[model samples]
Target: MTARIDLTLDCANASLLAAFWKTALGYADEPPPPPFATREEWLASFGPPEDGSEDDGAWLCDPDGAGPRLSVLRVPEPKTAKNRLHIDIRVPGHGTPAERWHRIRAEAERLVVAGGTVLAESDGHHIVMADPEDNEFRIAANPAA
Candidate 1:
């Protein structure tokens, strides 16, 4: 038997971030952040970028309700130290390295505009970026070649 596992993110707000991860990983949604009236109604409405989803918390959920979940919690303080752990993403390994890089590059770019930041880059195929709340994640170029 195996134990279920999920990663906890002690950040600033849960509902706000849960939406971003929902799109990035194509995962399902979780309950809306705390303290909102009529949670379901609030969840149905998506806010603009300028707002930064600041009112709600965030989550990097597991779609099937399996696999590791990335839960973002709202904290009173900021992240002042480095993350002790992180997640790495590699697309299906089937194509040229360059193709993988390009595909990954586009995803990374979209994430950046959506409030993610690139922390490091290695050629076109390798790049590191942080989520809206500074959670570090990687998106590698095509692995389908």
Candidate 2:
């Protein structure tokens, strides 16, 4: 018998990190649809409101569409230093290095707008980015320099 496995990340903003990874790795955001409290006055079947005090707002997804799902846990403390485990993304290059850079650049721009920092990357390699909580990751298609 084989055992299944999954990955989980404790992050500052689960939703934000999910979105960033969704784009960076082509993963679908499978966030559980919002659940609201079903008021007696209303005839809707809403479950309940999320516990504001718990670490419940987490993000999850299956990036490769083959591997087990990964989750990001929302927390109060900001991320410090580098992650013990990190994800490296690779996309099939269609044309020039400049073209690839452009695609990566666009992603960097969006991530930056969403509170990510562009650290650094080698030419034709990839760019280093940190999430809102400063969790660093590399986005690149090249496997070697």
Candidate 3:
């Protein structure tokens, strides 16, 4: 059987990164565990971190229930090196290469408004972007095979 998988990102500000990712991927926040009634109640049970560290991160899930779950964690340090692995957002497109690029540009603009910055782009292929905290990701065409 295939093992279930999830994605986790460690960042200086989990909440910000999570928000950016949630918007970029069109995912929804993962609901609280059963019997909790609300996220506040669930979080209250932890009694806060001992050092008073910020804990505003969240777990996000694909609303369609097909993509892997994403968990954001707050870390004490800043990112100093490029990510060894990163997410590539596949946006559906059709028609000529210019048309595909137009779609990508539109999505990239929307993401920029939602807290992502375009780092670079390669014509109709892909656009590299960074989340609020500087973690890199990409937007690319999802052409049918």
On TM-score, the candidate that comes out on top is 3
| Candidate 2 segments exceeding 4 Å error | 1-5, 29-55, 76-78, 142-145
lDDT of 1 by residue, 8-114 (tens): 77777576567667767777745556565554446556654464444545545666765577666676798887778876666555566676777788888887877
- Residue 63 accuracy (lDDT) in model 3: 98
What would the TM-scores of all predictions be?
A: 0.70, 0.63, 0.87
Model 3 worst lDDT window (10 residues): 49-58
Clashing pairs in 2: none
lDDT of 3 at 37: 79
TM-score of 2: 0.63
Better of 1 and 2 by lDDT: 1
lDDT of 2 by residue, 25-135 (tens): 566755454463322212134443544423344445665667567676776676666798776655555777788888777777776876778888776668887776677
Residue 117, candidate 1: Cα error in Å is 1.0
